[model samples]
Target: MTQTSATPLPPPEERRRLREAASLTQAQVAAQVGASRETVRAWENGRTTPRGHRKEAYAQLLSSLAAQTAAQEAVGEAEVTWRQQSTRPLTPAQAFDALYAFCAPALVRQTYLLTGRRELARESVERAFQFAWQRWPEVARDRDPAGWVRATAYDFALSPWHRFRPRYRHPEPPPADASDRALLDVLLKLPPPQRRALLLYDGVGLDLPETAAESEASTPATARRLLHARAAVADRLPALSDPTELHRRLAELASAERLRAAKPPTVRDSSERRARFWTRAAIAFTVTLIGTTALTLRTAPTRYEPPVPPGQTVLGVPPKVAPGPLSEREVELRRKLREETASGPVRLVPETR
Candidate 1:
């Protein structure tokens, strides 16, 4: 008979011991060691064994667990030794090292300020330490891991998708009074470039160069923007004062700026064009309307009366009378003259004959 040998099976007791040593939950260990939770469970139960890279990963995981346990045990021993050696309390530095290993007030403040989310900032710091612990050799050899950690925090804080990216979302105004409303009303009238320049410089108290940098504008451009912004605000200055009103004003300014940017430019043939196209168009329209109205009024017809009804007249007036019929005496005298004139050449005897 040929001799037969069996492959070694995973020991349930050893797997359980490794799990306990690693200070990790099954899920955590499974994730890190690239094994399924079921596979880890099987191994712990001595039902199956990992092979190839999986076996190596399993061994490394168990080793890491053992190291973590040892470190904790050592820390516990040291604490106990310290307690026995001194009845007095530990100094702040000693206490911090004992509790957190490392801590700094400036770092805390910066973490909070940058993240704007206290919890997230704290979590980030915690993860930084955890990462350092996992990769101590690398982090220890690096000359500026602290700088790297800070940069990570800042990157998280300044991400475009982060809520705190703008750092001025719905900025709280000083007060909610008439002055604020007035200030907003004035700011509303300004164009966007002017508004940005004015607010960044005057409202935010940035110097000219700083404002230009922030706005991504040239100094001369910024100055012009400020001038226009000032002119607009000044028109309503008597009423504006409150800071919250600034947002409303800025909204209006932004809208107007968008519209202006969207509007098409009027074409000019010459580079040195002095005339404003819109202004000229407006003047032309007004003149044309006036001329049309005048022409219409001049050409309108006049009303006619029937020539004052013949002889009838007004004011120092006159009137006409009908003509009389032929007189009866003239008819009888003509018959008598005819009888006497019957004689040839009747000597111009009067009709008395």
Candidate 2:
């Protein structure tokens, strides 16, 4: 039997150059990944990279499509096959940038709707980006990074601890006045399980199966949760007005989100910018001191002292009380004893007087 030698494949960089030279647009490339055009452009331009699950997916699509096209050509099809390879293999940075771009708009809008402040939305999304960056390696591998980030942001925003201890505070109303109200009303009408399913499905645009995974329920249960939530909103919509108005309002909210998307803040990494070292140290020291004091109090022993006696007379002696008299029958018995001694059997025997 004769063994066949497999030819080595070209690197992703060479493939990207070849694709670009072919005059195909980034959007056309991204259509293969089911991603937006911006994502493709960013990947090709070195602004980002495909990663993890996306990398495997991209590779599969590229290879499979290439094979199919080659087979078709052998059969006499004149259509040219487009190369669908990623510009680079998966990396954490590329994955972070991709997920950040994907989630930024939706997250920012949600922040605005909740707080009515674009600045707050910017801050929230920026922090969310930082968090996503920290977990980029894992998230990039996830099938739906966008939905994952949304759920995380929602959890962050709704944290009870945040109500009292916030990194920074901003008081603002939600955008799209009537729309906000209607959305809130609809949300309020939903039970917790149903609300979670509905938001993950409709608001974040996840399918029932994905929503089911997020909500920790079976597929049928998740479907039921969404149905119940929709029913609840539907029952209330008649009293509120046309349901289409709610959707229009939501679109208005989404549009408003675009206006509020600000460039994320950047911190310069320079040695000359050395600042806040002493202030940070002082804060740490203060917190440490407080914690130490609390620990000491918790571990300290308890001591109690006996009460002192009255000052004047004695240390341990108690006060005495007067004695009371016996009954009259004791006096009668004494008198009878004296008479018996005097009588002495009625005889004065040995009475010398």
Residue 253 of model 2 has an lDDT of: 54
In order of appearance, the predictions have TM-scores of: 0.22, 0.45
Q: Who wins the lDDT comparison?
A: 2
Candidate RMSDs in order = 27.5, 18.6
Residue-level lDDT of model 1, residues 1-353, one tens digit each, is: 11111223336796687677665688887897798899888888877877766777777667666678778889999999998878676653343233232332233334443333445445455544444444445655566555444444444434446445454454333224555445554544555456556665655455898777656789989988877676666566633344346434533332321111110111111111333555688899999999999999898867654555566446755656686675789778877678777663657654664
Clashing pairs in 1: 22-65, 179-241, 179-242, 180-242, 182-240, 183-240, 183-241
- TM accuracy, model 2: 0.45
**Residue 278 of model 2, lDDT score:** 50
lDDT by residue for model 2 (40-114), tens:
666656677676555555556556556655675665433322222344465665556565666686678765544
Which segments of candidate 1 are over 4 A away from where they belong?
A: 1-11, 88-353
lDDT of 2: 0.60
